[model samples]
Target: MAGISKSFFKAEPGQLVESDGELFKITHLMSISSVLAVNIKTNESVRLHVENLVPISPTEVTEKKYEERLHPDLALFSDDEWAEAQRRFQAIKPLLQNPIRTREDAETIATKHKIHPATLYKWLKLYQDAGHVSSLVPTKRGRKTGTKLLASEQEKIIESAIEDIYLSKQRHKPQDVIEEVLRRSRLAKIPPPHPNTVRNRLAVLSPANTLRRRGFKEAARNKYAPILGQFPGADYPFSVVQIDHTEADIILVDEAHRKPIGRPWLTLAIDVYSRMIAGIYITFEKPSATSVGMCLAQAICPKREYLAEVEVGGEWSVWGVMGTVHTDNAKEFRGTVLERACEEYFIDLQWRPVMLPHFGGHVERLMGTMANEIRKLPGTTFSNPTQRKGYDSEGMSALTIKEFERHIVEFIVNVYHQRVHSQIGMSPKQKWELGVLGDANSSGTGVMPIPADPLRIRLDFMPFFERSVQQYGIQIDGISYYDKVLDPYINAADPDNPKAKRSFLIRRDPRDISKVYFLDPVDQRYVPLPYRNIGYPAMSAWELREVQQTLKTQGMRNVDEHMIFEALDRMRVRIEEAKQKTKAARRQQTRIPLPKLPVVVFSKIHSPADKSMNQNERNFGMAEDDPFAQPIKPFDEISIIR
Candidate 1:
């Protein structure tokens, strides 16, 4: 009797052990270790040198019972079984003849007939729900088919449905699953649950009553698990954290604004390890340190605690001190005053290595995710101004640019940090918690802090320059800068010379730091300069380009001799016009008032319904001077139809 079960479904796990019945045919079997369990079925852990291994069902307690109801041909019940079924049906004819109108009536009749009334009632419900009107209807059915399930059961069903649909699953409808469960339970003489109960459970599970896919393809993902770790920031509420600039959109006046308030560059910061945003500030401008300062102030500066998790009167901080601050070589980040502040806090200034910009790639990715996630919140609006300004780091309000940011941070601290990450089956918060558990506190080797200098912070930011066609030396802020090594360029222009004209793009190097190099064409050679000490100095290429464009537009330069001749000729013409105007003025005497213009009126003139106007004629033009205008004589107007 091994490897045999499922003739009747045993609902309770323990009950399955007692039912010694067999149903499914193992036609496709070689040697089954375990049904649906890949690991045990493969037997990979312990390799056996046996020529044959047999699959034996040691415990026949499974709910996934199969049926031969599936058919390639319209097969029916066998001759004897059908004949016996007909005989049993005829024997039970009187119960059908006098239909019991109520459960009580059925029970009374059932007691007399020695039949289980509950069984008869269930069959009736099953028949009714399936449009058969028999006695097997589930217990949870009446008017509300889908709404009969309990809340927890509803949620479970919805979640299960979503997962199944995502896999393009078939075979089990909610009703079908319910019917099978009932069949199994009743087969073992256990009371079956109602269809309404199952339906109600599904309703509480999801009101939408539909399945949606998260749209991730496991096959396309890299064949490696995600590497996960943590980088802890401050400990107090928001004591000190690094603010990185990014842009995100959100809804404001909705219809008036059409889409969300866009062009709003999002400035936000996160606690390194918890991945929580300390604060956020958004504006319609280039992201700056000042904005970063504002966002940080909102986060670090304690205003109030609406509902305190910890005690009051203390600085609101989940992150307490600024540590080895990490950032790219952005100008806003490189300010000397900001560096001074960091120094005061004893925070180390760590500029991610040039060219290796993605060293701070985690923050960059976080910023991207912030934008994407908040974009879903775009149709959401706030009730007040401060929230819109992104000034308040925390408060109770409908989601605003600011409120949404806070929500984002909370999600990070609560959900993202707590759950096992998709990449690594460990949380960022868990990692940090582990680190802290490793060491309660440090000695004199305190956590690293940033450098703070108020006047102007000095950050070793990446720098480069763009190639220039020297027009009387590159002038920056009206002070002329000379590439005095013009001789090198001249010498290289001669075909006989072995040097490529050393033209270079003088822009901030997205990579490389310390020195500026005037690299030659094709980079055959480079003229390095000790720019930090001396040699070359000019504003950023972005600034210089703006100035240069302004000067060009204002006509600061022209073809010298050609403009001079043109100017002389223009001056003579101006003199002649002045004399003519003077003469005309001398002869002028009286003034006359201007005449008024005739008013224009646009009034609709509906034509008589001879269907005079074609749809094109009605919409195409005005009364006069219309290109598509056709002259219709009063004598001839006709109507046509197809």
Candidate 2:
């Protein structure tokens, strides 16, 4: 006992210890008092002398013991019998530590521990041979084979049934698959598997594999395939720009009449590196090559007084030639004009692979965020009709185009740009500055400058048409344009063939039909050509088409310039009537207006016909007129009636 005690170490708190042939867990160690506070097997608390305590190993305390001496078959033993066996083994543990050379020696040690000599010798031999306490634990006493249904032939049948019947588009049940397996097994003269066994086997199949087997390739890919890699980000501002177009969820009214015009399409460009919006264009026109061109033009050109015009107070400052433009495979993005425009500016154009939306996720996400903001506005259609159910979007729409544009500008500058972006961990404005300057307080001397020849770039992106200069003027889509700039090219012969009439490349802004740009081949300069009927009001391509359709509906022939203008006038009257009738328009009239800078009006030399026309004709003649223009009221003296 003394020898054993000398070899044994002090037991710590929470250690399993043996005292008086009973297992006790040391709850606390009172080193000062040389006593251990212990919980007995029955969970009774008691204090014991530290000298009497011997630490028991976790394996000895927890592991079940068996009756079999060598590789004991523990399966036959009940829980009480196993526990008794473990106690017996623990009793003989101290004696086994000393070597027993003979049967007499084993008998002496067994007598001291109160165990049979034969049993003692057997346990000693077993412990010596295995050299591990776990080896003393007996396994279950039976053939350790798993279910007989897992045989190769049975497994093959089960797998075949699962593939053919269970994992299918029809979504066959597990019981049906089991039945199919049983039927197949019966035909082959093999014993049928239990239904539960078949179900367990089928349950092991992965969800992705099941989906794939059911002909859901996309679902399988989404569930099991690795996520798409992050976009190879740009190092500097404008190194990569992503552009996309989305229809705004909110309905907007015309600036003049304040009647619901419908949802406007917005083309937006975002700088990939800084996550800053480079430019945006909002219009009622559908997304086309012309829209893309207009967006790109705005993106590259330096923003002048646009912020002021929109009543926004921050410096937008984002502008420059993009090194690379990334976009999805939209018709507008794939147009030759867009390609040529990019090529002219040495910009690399990349189209994302089909169905891989993650490539252009930055711009797409920006558009989504913008749409969510728009959904909070007064007249949002809420992305889809399901979400817009019970909401009167058209009736609630109270924002004019100019007002909406201002709100968007304000949101971009004051809200979106200033908010800390989750991905970048900084505001877009800060990121833009960091990307441009590399350090806080540093000037943006390294920023890429805007193109020197902005007009040339603009002309390259504008929608163009090939027309010959006739004796009267160049007729474009039923409208004739004339300018002194076209005089040099008038009746000009083709350089290649003298007899053939020369065709000139004419560029026009869809937003304004009052003027067109004629590319002069001789000097390579664009010549601005005004409409032949200068009095004809500037109209968008969409408005012009609408008026043309209206005329066609009315069965009106001779769709001349005068008739077109008259149709526009009639449409204006209808729009005004709609404004007066609409509850939304009346609500808009009551909202307090924001303070704006005085609009700068540029003097224009009116044509003879424009001078002779009324004030309404002059108001809508140019596309550049103040969008927030108000009708002038005639002055009258105040009368005091008695």
Say which candidate scores most in lDDT.
2
Residues 131-197 of candidate 1 have per-residue lDDT tens digits of 2111121224343223223334444544454345322335246666566555555555655556665
RMSD to native, candidate 1: 37.8
Looking at model 2, report the run of 10 residues with the lowest lDDT sum: 1-10
Worst 10 residues of 1 by lDDT: 1-10
Per-residue alpha-carbon lDDT of candidate 2 for residues 396-443, written as tens digits (9 for 90 to 100): 998876778888888988899999999999999888877765665554
Candidate that would win on TM-score:
2
- lDDT scores for all predictions? 0.37, 0.67
**Model 2 CA lDDT for position 256:** 54
Which stretches of model 2 miss by more than 4 angstroms?
1-232, 256-259, 383-391, 440-445, 453-455, 547-642
* Clashes per model (N, Cα, C within 3 A): 80, 0
Candidate 1, residue 561: lDDT: 26
What's model 1's lDDT at 84? 33
Residue 148, candidate 1: how far off, in angstroms?
88
Residue pairs with backbone overlap in model 2: none
